[model samples]
Target: MAHHTLRLRVRRITPEAEGILSYELVASDGGRLPPFEAGSHLDVHVPGGFLRQYSLCNDPEDTRHRYVIAVQRDDHGRGGSRAMHELVREGDVLTTSYPRCDFPLLYARSYVLVAGGIGITPLLSMAYVLRRQRVPWHLHYCTRSPERTAFRSRLVSSFAGRVTFHHDQGDPSQGLDVKALLATRTGGTRLYCCGPAGLMRSVREAAILHQWPREKVHFEAFSAEATGAITDRADTEFQVVVRSTGATFPVPPGRTVLNVLRANGMRVPSDCEAGSCGTCLTRVLEGEPDHRDSFLPEPQRTTCRNMLVCVSRARSRKLVLDL
Candidate 1:
């Protein structure tokens, strides 16, 4: 389906920075928001910066007047989070894409959800769905410190027993026991995790080492950027042949293939340009896809088939693009 932009009024901007600040807004169209699943995320467009995805924290079944998003100001951010934390206000209007998500919740007799920092946004919805359905689930929210965490009060008040809050900044010993948790989980259980790439990687490795089914463990990252090392080593002089357009361009040593294509007037849909979302995914007809994006399954990378143009590149000469 063609993507349609929505003019959503900033109905609410709640911040959980050592406390809570309720900033409510209304729908510009005064209509019901699009129906989305438990893990769906909304793409908030902050111009001159990036289009970052935020999970719909409010109940999807709630035909409320408008939508809700909770954001915490991050200091070392590249604009989106800071913009959302500082610039966004109640009643302000902004255009955003409908909810899109990679971490889909599945049927599991029991669930183990792990969230790190702002990664709690999506997990919030998952917990909400599970609670409403009376499904058994628990959350392990890991934050740098309690001072920077969002939605602290509500998460505790509502899910006192079902949730476990961990402040990694204060003490590492209080960290969530992923190894033990995964080991004790029943067979029909599924695990969902969202947070830092390091945590996700560690969880995946531990689960694999424990022989957990890869398909049963689902995760998504809030932000991921290409390391300067990878972005610097490659020469940007390779030829990218658009099989359909028969056009070529010089991708600068530090520029992404997606940027070059967009500069040349190609209409490519992208969100969280950090290669987190599969939004910029393109089928690879030939050549090896550098495959930097975490969106691709580990096994599929061998095929070197699909590529996320937003932040990935080619390891060989003569890259053929299906665009």
Candidate 2:
């Protein structure tokens, strides 16, 4: 299905941290925006026509008039963050996709929230909901240093005694010991983590080593590449056959199925081509998919019934897609 788009006016832009900026966006028509959950994110259409996903950090209950998002400028990475920082300004109009959530807050007796660096955006919203619900929860926010920690003051002021800040000063060894923190599994306690690939991996590995219930652990990555979804293995040439049209296309190595379909004049909608977004998910009629996407849950990946064409490829010589 095609995702809904919104034309929003940039209401305000405030500095959140050393290199982080928060944007307050409101509907251009002065209407109430659609409500979203705590971990929802918006696919922002930034300058240069690049669609980047930014987590909504504002309280979900306060979305009656506006949506809030934070952008961390990454000079070493892609140009999306750079464009958002350099070209976007207050009062500017921008296009964005409706809010979507893959990292939703699940029901549990108690919750442990771990966030690393800019990964705090969605977890911050989760904190708001958990507080409102009066649920037992704690946030362990880790950053390189206090100066680079976004929303530190807000977190401390609003969630005193419930939030802990960890500064590693550019060393992983000094950061939170994920293994020790999750050494014991508490009954009815769920763990949610969003952060750098290393942190999330550590959390996942620790949870597995400690024999925590897989269903009780959740993760949301900033990019598939960081999670090893896009580069874990080399790609091989394959064929994609459209079930409806009976037309086939060759998918060469290093090329994505979405791009191949689009180049062939097929209109496949996509947002984050990194496979972190589910915008380009397509049903598979036949053949197994080498699922490289971080968006699909375990069930979906195991079933191999649907695949995100953005980053996933076919395991068989040819894949018959519902298209």
Candidate 3:
């Protein structure tokens, strides 16, 4: 889909916790905002020419008023959150993409929702939808302490018994036991987790060791870590052939297939360049893909039918894409 660029006025900005700020966005003309699903996110273009994605935290049923999002300042990040915290203010007009959801709540008998830090934004919306549908669900939110937790009071008061808090308090040893939690119920339950790399790795490892069905496990990683073959691959040049135009482009070392295409005037949709979001997914008409993205499942990656061009590279000498 083409990126939908719209001007939204920042209606309100409030500090929800330490280093965290919540912003309410609405139409500049006071018209109704676009409708979005429970787990949808908006790609907001802040200063520094960067587009950052933030989850929609408000109730999905109420779409007439405003869209809410929380930003946690990551001093070590790519200046996305820092810009929102330091530069953005109320009444400022911001350009943003329409709402899109890659991590959606699926049908299940029961659900186990896990979140860490700002990752709770999307899951919080899922909780509201689940509650209205009367579906069985549980939420486990982990943070450093009470002072660092966002929306703590509302979560505790609204969900109450369904929510669980795990605070590390600067101690790694005191963190939640992921293995024990996964070991309790392995059947008839779907697990959804979004958080820091460490927390996500723990959950993934536990699920793998417990032989959990692949379909039952779901995750959405907002950041890309440099520990995988994506960074270790020998930088080599490849070629991309656009099927419609019969044109070929050279993908030089140190660049992605998507970058090569866009630099050559081909417009491709992309959200999180980390490959976590499937926005840049393109059909692989021919050629093997060196699948480094975490979005596609192992089975689909094995088929070589499609690839997320933002981060994934070609394994063969040339790749034919349905551009």
TM-score against native, each model: 0.71, 0.75, 0.74
Q: What's model 1's TM-score? A: 0.71
Looking at model 3, residue 267 earns an lDDT score of 96
Q: What local distance difference test score does each model get? A: 0.69, 0.83, 0.80
Ranking by lDDT: 2, 3, 1
Model 1 CA deviation exceeding 4 Å by range: 18-25, 170-174, 224-323
In Å, residue 243's CA in model 1 sits off its true spot by 8.4
Candidate 3, residues 91-164: lDDT per residue as tens digits? Answer: 99998887877678888889999998888899999999989988789999989998999999989989989999
In model 3, the clashing pairs are: none
lDDT of 1 at 285: 79
- Measured on C-alpha atoms, candidate 3 has an lDDT of 0.80
Please provide, for model 1 over 223-301, each residue's C-alpha lDDT reduced to its tens digit, 9 standing for 90 to 100.
Answer: 4221111222323346678989789776644446877898799988875455555778998777776666666777877
Q: Report the C-alpha lDDT of model 2 over 26-108, residue by residue, as the tens digit.
A: 99999999999999988777886555678899999889899999988876654677788999999999988888776789899
